[model samples]
Target: MADAPLNGIRIVELAGIGPGPFAGMMLADHGAEVIRIDRPGRGGITIDAKDPLLRSRRSVALDLKKPEAIAAVRRIVGQADGLIEGFRPGVTERLGLGPDVLLADNPRLVYGRMTGWGQTGPMAHEPGHDINYLAISGALHAFGRAGEKPTPPINMVADFGGGGMMLAFGMLAALLHVQRTGEGQVVDAAMTDGSALLMSMIWGFRGMGRWSDRRGENLLDTGAHFYDTFECRDGKWISLGAIEPQFYAEFRAVMGLDAPEWDRQMDPRSWGPLKAELERRFREKTRDEWVAAFAGHEVCFAPVLGFDDALADPHNRARGTFVEAGGVTQPAPAPRYSASATVAPTMAGERDDAGVLRDLGFAPQEIAALGH
Candidate 1:
């Protein structure tokens, strides 16, 4: 919509993997005009621009190996409100598109840099992925079973949670600062820093002596049978998280556990036996049966669903959580507003060099000179 919060905002994206594209997607979802600069003749981790992360944007292939490409990027930056890139600390500098140079051309531009370690750490220039960044951030150490080795949560916590979302937030904040003070700055959004920040609640628990550093030994972890997934008779899984006494009472009543011995819910000794008994009971029914039994009760229950199931879920259908756009089935834009509902994502892999130049008020001859 024309009145969307970021309606008139413009962003230039230096195409990259994972977090970089996701951040740009977030901005573009909220009405930022994000134009991604794809590198010419380069192979990507995947050529699937239809992936949800790369949605809701336009693209232009630019070979930074050439001086003309660098000039083109600078020109776009000069007209943009923000720019996002996820290269190592000095890669953009080597390409002459560093924050110093870009900001010189556009003082109100928000230069957003995404990295794994950070810009000035000992490992700043090193190669790393989501798992490596999470390992160093201490967030990966708190997942999985009590005795098993630490298990990573498939890159969501670090990559999308810390890296991409954090960069998007930093870019927005910098843009707000520019609007207020007319000062542009570089937003150094590092996954390592953000992943650690994500663990702030766990760190608080540890500081208060309510949490153990051991993986899966905490209240929120799988330490409590009430807060974990259990296999059902149909080889399906259901999750329960009845942490409070009231919720547990509701669950106990619904399950018809009238035994007085099961009353000591908080005793660690009871937890093991209770878990075994519950496992046996859960095995007596399919996952759907358990979902039905807990439907009206406040047991904090849910059947574990796969991707396709999630898309077809009643709640998801009602909320329009997943949408079909550009021949892709993917998640819809988030944080709904009273007005200006999100636009459907578009397929993005076309080069419009002349149109881009024309947007910068270039004459016909100049636009023709800026060839693809």
Candidate 2:
């Protein structure tokens, strides 16, 4: 951990849910000393100590409604490099820990704000979750079948991808700015904006007249026969992405798709029929059988693994893609570094409140006054 890129950085996290905790986890995984300020009592979507998102951070339970707690947060942030919060707009300002106050206390503090609608839009103060955010971002419209209602990708796109990950990136960018200029700024990371930004390539495709507004009618949205999932004989699934001509030819050659109609690889009218043929062909073999068939081929094939299968997958195991911590199996820290390797995750555990406060140079009397 000494060589970790964020080893010397400290972050104060005003814990809420979802993206805020995820950002803190990303920072903590990279060796930032992320101290999370949790509510004194559990409420909506509480993250238990063993939750992977809470890993590698020390939690301090403080009632932000209390004046002493607010002061304690200020004391902590005054010496920290960054702070993350996911409250609705104006909530932190009401609690007296807004960016203005914290940045005044520490001029180089990168204040990261996570929200679904951003800090200034008309819907900034509205209450919404991942689905609602994707709905507004136009990402949801591109997620379903050709004639089906758009399916949510189970919060992965907006919550973790756009919201939390983008906040982490913004925090690091702002932190870099702070290092260079001895100044800080607010990072308004809105899920809506981030999700829309994620669609840049698709927007470009649309602008180039290669994409349509219709759902699942584009090349990558499962509209093409070569780019969709298929059910196997055993009821398990497999996916294909044989978009390139060579790969598609390999797919057809391997699957015995020698009919004349199968040559129309890019014809929209032939996709539905080709997909039907693929469905029938795939159901002729079990998922494992198909996996074995495509093992050394370049058909862009993979089995759609479930959690247990994913954990036990040979490729995943070889790459150490998942690790066990605190008796729970979860994904490992990603984007591995050659020089600044990230720290292995540890479970969130009980902390000595007074010890933590003392490390922060808080006197015993002051700690007691804060009811720590």
Candidate 3:
């Protein structure tokens, strides 16, 4: 993709699980030449070539326990624009491939470090998954119903949204700074920080006294009758979000809710009974029937589609939101550009040790000595 936004950019990704690979995938999707350094005989969570996160990049397997392998990584990073690594704070330092060494080798290298707790905190070295990070960030407490346990959104919020996407943004920002100043810097992208940042709007609502600390007692958290999912007659679900007065009026008109009690749309006391009534009313029709009834209306309604249905959806199909690679269906690269078109994703392929080394300007003797 010669016209892609990141066409000339090159990223060296030290393989790890979760956010690290996702960041690499995002970069690679937009035409960054991302060289993934995988551990020898260990694939991490991206188990094989077909894994979506590993797509659109060439991989090189190297045993970091060996000093020669470390040298090889330095050699690769010397010519690269950036590097992404997800490890505990001091792990890379112990491996002799820390920011100091790599930045010394290449002054213009943007180094990105992804972690759950960040680089300097007391919990930085402690092991944690996305759930722990989200919990500590104060985002998880607002996730579930009012009286229920906080439901984890299955790692999507912290891991992919906050962690990986944040790292990608930081990497790109640092790379742009390198372009302008001829200087490189490290990006410490912490899931805790990122997840908290993702809740900025909620924090604003809290400060403005428009939000409740209770999970499901807020406007956008299914507290409103019009802003929640309802089960249909066929056992499927549909969601509604008619927040504005006009939209709520449209909802009432479309649904034929002529009851006088429905006038108290904002009265929280009426929410429970109204929601019960809505539940009963929605159950009178199938999901598809309701979808048809709400078609071409301004009620902000949509079916609660599962993955298979989402992939098959008409709108998603029109936008090419999902694509197939290596016979596996997955989401396409997002945030489409108007001028710089992105490259289509390709499945991860076999490691090309010598090929990658040669591309990094390694001599034949040095490549031989490193031993793939």
Candidate 4:
């Protein structure tokens, strides 16, 4: 096993849905000793035996409604550096595992709370999903074609980005605070808040009058001809991200686009015609041919690859970006560190109660009692 960056950090994840497991996986990926507490009988939606994101972490199935489960969690929390939970507001408080109770026992434990809405809004208690959260966060509005109903970005916006990524970031930030002041704090990571934060760049663009709420009309939102995907000859697609003036010029030059007419780069009126012309040119070649042509160029071109294709790509294979573990091949750890690298383990299974408790400083007898 490689030396993990967060080997000394311990986290307890009270499992729910979506982002909770993802955030737990992120912490576990970086060498944090993350324990996922499942409420016995909670079946996961998808199970890939070799997926790397599921690596690391021990699981402990407990019924939080029971006194025994509550006590067990308290003991675990007492020794943990962080605790993450994704339940509707008040669920943890009702279980007696709330921030107030846990922080009282471990002043240095960062309590990370993940929710769709915020912690203190009128809609906090309302049932919602990724789509609902993104809708309210202004993310959905910035997606899809102009003057058309907004399309969902496959729940990636709220579930992973706003929910999981934000929770991880907030937990890390809180960990820094605990290290400084020895006082643990509650991290309210709401999907709505996170989604809005993800749009900070767009917000800045809007402030500078370079963006509009209408979708398919901005440089980054597929509104520009140079920053969108086009169909190729084989029915596959290729993405082009020649956003800057120099890159666009290089891209046009590579494709042999003529001057004067092609020089009208940022004109809104010329956008539709330019896109049509570019589409025609893109259709002349297969995705593979285009990839071969732009093998080493500043055109910022790539195939719109699916997951299976992504794993098989030459660049991905060369970099070992994906690994086979637990009979599955999934993405490897990211953001490599020079000194402390992440280790990729096989897919995790059900939580190992006795084994995990022993590692967390329980006596043999105590482990046996917990099993009972």
Q: Give residue 2's lDDT in candidate 4 (0 to 100).
A: 55
- TM-score for all predictions? 0.95, 0.97, 0.97, 0.94
Residue runs of model 1 more than 4 Å from their true location after superposition: 42-47, 363-370
| Candidate 4 ranges beyond 4 A from true positions | 42-53, 363-371
Better of 3 and 4 by TM-score: 3
lDDT of 4 by residue, 67-110 (tens): 87798899999999999898889989998998889989888889
Query: What does candidate 1's lDDT look like per residue over 164-253, in tens digits?
Result: 999999999988899899999999999999999999998999999888877776788888768888999999999989989999999899
Q: Give the lDDT of residue 352 in candidate 4.
A: 64
Model 3, position 152, has a per-residue lDDT of: 88
Q: lDDT at 199 for candidate 3?
A: 96
RMSD of each: 2.1, 1.9, 1.7, 2.4
- Tens-digit lDDT track of model 3 for 118-143: 99988988999999999999999999
Weakest ten-residue segment in model 4 by summed lDDT: 42-51
Residue 338's C-alpha lDDT in candidate 4? 74
Show where candidate 2 strays beyond 4 Å. 42-47
Candidate 1 C-alpha RMSD relative to the actual structure: 2.1
lDDT of 2 by residue, 295-365 (tens): 88899999999999999999999999999998989999987887788879988766556677888888999
